[model samples]
Target: MTASRLPQFSGKTGRPELMVILGSTLTVIAILGIVTFLLIREHAGAKETATRSATTIAQLIDADVLRTVELYDMTLQGLIAAAQRDDLRQVSPQIRHLVLFDRSTTARFKGDILLLDKHGEVLADSSLIEPRPGNFADRDYFQAHVTNTGSGMYISRPFKPRCDCEDSNEWRISFSRRIASSTGEFLGVAVASMRLTYFDQLFNSLYIGSDSTLNIIDDAGILLAQKPYLEHDSIGKSFATRPNVVRILREGSGSFESVSSIDGRQRLYTFSRVGNLPLTVIVALSGNDVFAAWRRTALVISGATGVLCIGLLWLSWLLCRELRLRHQAEQELAQLAATDSLTGVANRRILDLTLRHEWFRAQRSGQPLSVLMIDADHFKAFNDRHGHQGGDEALRTIAKVIAANVRRPADLVARYGGEEFSVILAETDSTGARQIAEKIRMAVQQLPKTEGDELPMTVSIGISTWTTQTDVTLEQLLFAADKALYQAKEQGRNRVVAGS
Candidate 1:
């Protein structure tokens, strides 16, 4: 043994092994870098495309709504002028005769023409009612019309007819103007009630794929018409209870997401106010549907990323293993930073960033902004009735429902604190804000309540409207919503109330 002492191998200086390891590591790093770059580019592109698509759809819907309102205004003006002259009998005859004799007016403005007195009493109607002596004096539309002395027009929320119709109780959207006597004293109201079905048909014509839908709500947030009408109390109920819709109305216009009150489908929504009218036209498409293309792109990117990662691993084993490991660790860290740990929705940090971006956009566009503060009613009571585990489940379910109801891509719904959530509605107004709150209320009521609880678990919503005077401060909006929420809770639980 002493005669044959051979040189020992250090295991660090095998030229062939070193070269193989370096080459493999370099190849993997290069592949991963390329994949990462491609993924980033694709993500940015897809997001931009989605934003543009949403914006375009919003503009189109807004224009259509305004046009429809303008038409309504014109019709009201004509009817009022006729009423002022006390020539309803003559004009009524002409409208009926035109419907019978002329095909043009019949086809275009497809509905029975009607004349109502000062109190919304039916004086003359195309569809003849027995005795012709019913009074609509108590109707909100009639009251509103009589009071509006301003040049602005008055449009009513959808309502069912008091008189029985051959057709089932159909919803009608009415436009009214005050009738004046020869001396210019207010006498009565001249009104027209257009069947909401007409709007249903109109909105149905706008096709944006299978999951897309269009809806119209009055200034009060009552759903006037929708395609594929699902019968629920929500159809004629005040929208003020819906947190999401309230946010939209207060903001005056823009997009948000929410669960469909009808079918519970999660939707991305965009809305526009009818210029010079208290009406909102909302267009909603399922987020899943809208982003299906982007999802596919992401999946492809993900798969490529995985392959690149595997390649990196292989290359690291053959090349500079330590360096490759360090690089991979860094990449993972960045991903973690961007992701939310709980609920999988974007975290508050991300929301803050988004709010800032949205704020600037809204400011440049000169649109109103609103935020909703939502609190689960008697959540602690629920927890007391059912253990913490049950409470957790309830919270999760509520969160999912709230998330589903949000209707716009730009709208953000976030868990603000324990048992509280916030929704951001852009380009809305006070009346619109209240409607949304009511919608949210009805939606939560539909959810399964805790068993054996003294009272049913519900949500209280507070909405605050923002304008240029308010500036673009999230804190101000939040405070406004909080104050409104306090009022809602004070008035009663499970209600939506608005802030000043």
Candidate 2:
């Protein structure tokens, strides 16, 4: 009942099974590697995408700020062009009002356009108070324009507008140009006060987060205007000392990651100098907000990877199961093929295979291989006297006797054919083969009988042996043993004959 053949292959599965496990393990490793690579790529891609998007936003807003400042300067340029008239000092007050307030209807203008007289006195104002109340000089833009009549459109740093009419705490930057005579004598300064709300209203529509920032600063990094304006004194505050501003100045326009000097938050910063103006526009995005979109993408990718890992594991299990079952069935089929149904000994198919394998082993070891060819003596006569049942029983008895006499694990006894048997002895010489052949012959001579005739049974055996040094092939060895068997039958029925 025990599976002796099965035990030979027990603890270890075959090469195909090993390959399944090895291949599966490697596949899992490769999957993990791919996931790692994907995650790294996704991380880099997400950061890059965030940086580019921020830069685009910055560029768009930079264009808006540039246009706003340029328009203010263009108004000053128009005023200065009008002052070139020779008889302008003699023009009617009505005509002068037409010249000063010509650009007032535009809603984009959040500040007053003023014309100053000699020594920075506010002569005519765009806001149109009958006797315009303030401003005799001293602003940087005023000083710059008075000193150099040719100074083209000067933009001053962030400052509070000096006015007496309807006043507020709000700040505005000034854009100024000089009004001069044909001989280059400074007549006065024409000024435009750029309202802070201009920049705020422009940036308010954007959805940058609380910690995020949108600001425009002069070349000296003085805060010109900012959205979500600082409750503290950020207006007129200098940021030129910060490293981020220095880098922006050096690069002119680019995106980078940096820590904020104000909020101390890490941000992806996109900045550019506003179109030939001394102003720089900045858009800063918080780190958490920048990575938020990437987190969602990574979650989806991880979910898919988790599902794939499970699927791969399941596939490996199923494959190994199927392969193991098929391997077991093949092993069982091989066992059946090599075993004899009637005698329980090796059949002729196995005998041939075992002899070939042993022959090669003996050759390699430089040892002698011996074969015993046994035939049941007078088997046909016994079958004729007692029917086939009795004959079959006699054959069974002889098989058991042959099997019992061969003791070594390396020795094999097989039913070679009808009434013919064989024994293959490994590492055996002629004398050893002859002795075992005689023992099997005597054992067959004493087969027990519980029925019909009580006639004694015997087997005539022929022995053959060869060493690698001998000129004998496996076929030649087999032929010599068969010939010796015929001779044993010729001389007597129950003896052994050995062939050289």
Question: Candidate 1 at residue 283, lDDT?
Answer: 72
TM values, all candidates = 0.51, 0.57
Q: Candidate 2, after superposition: displacement of residue 9 in Å?
A: 12
C-alpha lDDT score of every prediction, in listed order: 0.67, 0.78
- In angstroms, how far off is 190's CA in candidate 2? 3.5
For candidate 1, lDDT tens digit of each residue in 376-444? 988887888788889877767766666667666666666666788777776776777677767777888
Clashes of 1: 50
Candidate 1 segments exceeding 4 Å error: 1-41, 54-65, 86-112, 127-131, 181-184, 229-233, 256-266, 320-500
lDDT of 1 at 152: 59
Instruction: Give the best candidate by TM-score.
Output: 2
